[model samples]
Target: MAGVVTGDDVRITRKVQQLGSSTLAVTLPAEWAREHEVEKGDSVVVQRDESSGSLLVVPDRTLVEDAETTVDASGLDADALGRAVVAQYVLGRRLVHVVDDGPIAPAHRDAVLDAERGLMGVGIVEETTEAMTLRCSIAADDFELPTLLGRLDRTETTMRDDALAAFLDGDAERARAVEQRHAQVDKLFYLLLRVLFATYRNPDLNRAVGVDTGFPLIGYRSVAQDVVLMADAATDLAALTGEPIPATAREHLTGLEDAIDDAADAARNAVVDPSYADVTRAREALDRARNRTDAANESLERERPEPLLRLQRAVCALSGDTRHVRDTLDVATRLTFRDGSGATPE
Candidate 1:
């Protein structure tokens, strides 16, 4: 039977004790059971280990008729998936698995692989299978977890706003400013990573969550890198010294920009409302934009030294921005589910 001991306050000691039967036993402190209103007749759950000859006892969970329990999403959407992985890292869940029902796309898989290198103690275990597992030994917590996500969001926003403004205003100074801002974002990203890894090393949080959360952490880092790269490319386009962007190129760039914005907006709905409809629509739009950009790039290559090469290179680079934007939406979508939205909770 488990019991508690009292000092200045009722307390419990969790440990292992040796038994003569080649086993280890832990006694519950008497004061604890009394304080908890536990009686001799009350049932308790005891977990036994044959390998180590150990036993773990607790108040019998089965005895409770209506216990409050939170449901874990065994299956996750993009947004929810990212947050879970991040939470796992913050909680020090090191061995994270992001398994899908079908085979993942090569691009998506590559993105995850890149994330593994960018994040601490993160790596891809099985990329070719129906479900992929990412492993990382990191700790995540409520306090700093949101902050890390927030910093990444801010980085994307800053880059997009700066680059877009520079392009519109035709200002070299603005382009330089946008580039300079990257340094700040980079610094914050590093700091967030440091905090995440530091939490992983802490015994308490690490023990609580385990390694499963690393996939999300790595995923988030990957998104941040994508955003940074996208923004940098956009800023470069804005700084390009070409004949005022051609009418066709300008129109195409504008369309791509609008599509990127739409994708981000669609993701917002998924994050806030979590309807599959919204995610589906966003995915479709993103796919179309990617295809259009590819076609535009090909056409430009064929018409080179004539009119579109300069614009094409600049615009193609901006495709990276769109992809990162999509990932950001995915991140946001993951967060909405965590806030207690069943299908898009609030």
Candidate 2:
């Protein structure tokens, strides 16, 4: 006997039986059947899932209401209101209202506008003097975690590469562009957060989000944060473009940059599709990056009294920020042992 699928904390076990020479059937619970308005002659829709070898029965279409909440922004400041809006979005709220007893302050209104622009798939549907409504039109199946993670990886890689080029080439315009492009990565990160958090709250959405409920979901969250940290480090490198960069500093950092370029790409791939071979490749590249960063840092201490003084702080900050890429190796190692299991519902 196998347990039938239903809501949490309840299980209905059933045994398969023969109907006719070439047919099989299982009796549905009378209580469940009556609740769904299904009768003996009713034709319930049956969907067969090839991957899990499971059949889904739908007696009728049920309309699910969107989840919503109302936030009273009476005395909250701009920063407070902004945080509130983001909090609701991450909690899977589909509709949010920022209301006050009377007309909301100008600063609070601007804060809501900024929050809406920052979040993905969230827009203002209606606005009045006293209240503003934000509507999130995204679904669980809208974007898979793997695909979203890939997009983040690509964007961060491009930004880092451009920022590094601007740093080493002393290109001011390109540096500005790199800094500006950082926002896109943040947007992707937030969207990923929404999906991951929502999926966590509703384990049934595992298939819809394209990541399993337990370990795979946690790994994606960690990897996404690491990528964002790398982007921040890259932006730091960009900011140093017009700084008084010493020749020795640039020469020392070049090796580290090269190592990270390979290490980050390899590590991201391994996290997304983990295997022994990919994990080994990522580990090797990360080792190279670590060694290079250590050497780069040591060079500053061994230099003359003020040789790297002007560039020491920027170099240290950039190196430390980018080192977060090393954390992804742990995730890759753990996932490699998962044997590609739990990728789909059972």
Candidate 3:
């Protein structure tokens, strides 16, 4: 027999412990009793060990502590779709279910079936007159946070490039297309944020994914916000060029385009490289772009007296666009680097 004492107020007594044919058993630990709020009269749940013929009496609180969430993906089950959801949950999927009541789409149903037997299992748990429930088990190896982030970054880059190119080409139709792309960017950005929220909610999934997502997500968010601004600047530039500008104004616009190109190139490189030295160089180039815009604005003020007021206003608009371009580059550079002491997150 063994005995444990915690001062005079608490004392634990132990008896013989059984092993085999000549085995014996003892009472539960007193410390565990106090920790679990179990008293002499309090009830507990007894769970039998499958392999070891041992009974484990645990407090009810332990069972109720863990929460299981359900993700609804009814009638729209595909192999890829299931895999995607499983992957999402592994990064930390709560309770996910697929239900089909009325006429469900074939593709969706297929996706739901396809998701079965991977990390997530497809099982029919309940049925009703209206709908049937298919539940899936979420496992760890399902989500790759870095890969997802890369995909999102690529999508953002594509949209930004398309919008900037359309504005530079002076094609109103093409610039209009950028608006549609912006909607896509917005959707993607929202989806990524949801994934991040899941990461925070599910700790096991986060450990399994083994990614340092906090920083990258911040960077992507900041960059995405900047790109949205970039898209707006493109829209404004498109409006500025809708009418036939004067020959002098056109020349000035062309120079602004050249300045914008240089600044964009510098910013893109800085964003990709994300080094202090590279950002410093990009910042220098942007400063020069600002000087170019100022010079062009002053030239219009002096050389074109007849339309001086209108010319100045147009110059201001173009300069504002350039300023936005500069700011985007600055943000990209800040996000690229690790030790940005005073930089904003994302």
lDDT of 1 by residue, 158-270 (tens): 66666665664466677777776766565456546545454333323423332223334444455556555665675676566434444444556666666776676566445
Would you list the C-alpha lDDT of every candidate in the order shown?
A: 0.56, 0.77, 0.52
Task: Please write out the lDDT profile of model 3 over residues 85-204, one tens digit for every residue.
Answer: 555443433445444445545676555444443332446566444333455443333545444444544554454445444444546676577555555554444444444544433333
lDDT per residue for candidate 2 within 264-297, as digits (tens), equals: 7777787778767666776677677678778776
Question: Between prediction 2 and prediction 3, which has the larger TM-score?
Answer: 2
- lDDT ranking from best candidate downward: 2, 1, 3
* Full ranking by TM-score: 2, 1, 3
Q: Tell me each candidate's RMSD, in Å, in order.
A: 17.3, 7.3, 14.5
Better of 2 and 3 by lDDT: 2
Candidate 1 vs candidate 3, TM-score winner: 1
Off by over 4 Å in 2: 1-66, 243-249, 303-307, 340-346
TM-score of each: 0.47, 0.76, 0.46
Q: Give the higher-TM-score candidate: 1 or 2.
A: 2
TM-score: which candidate is best?
A: 2
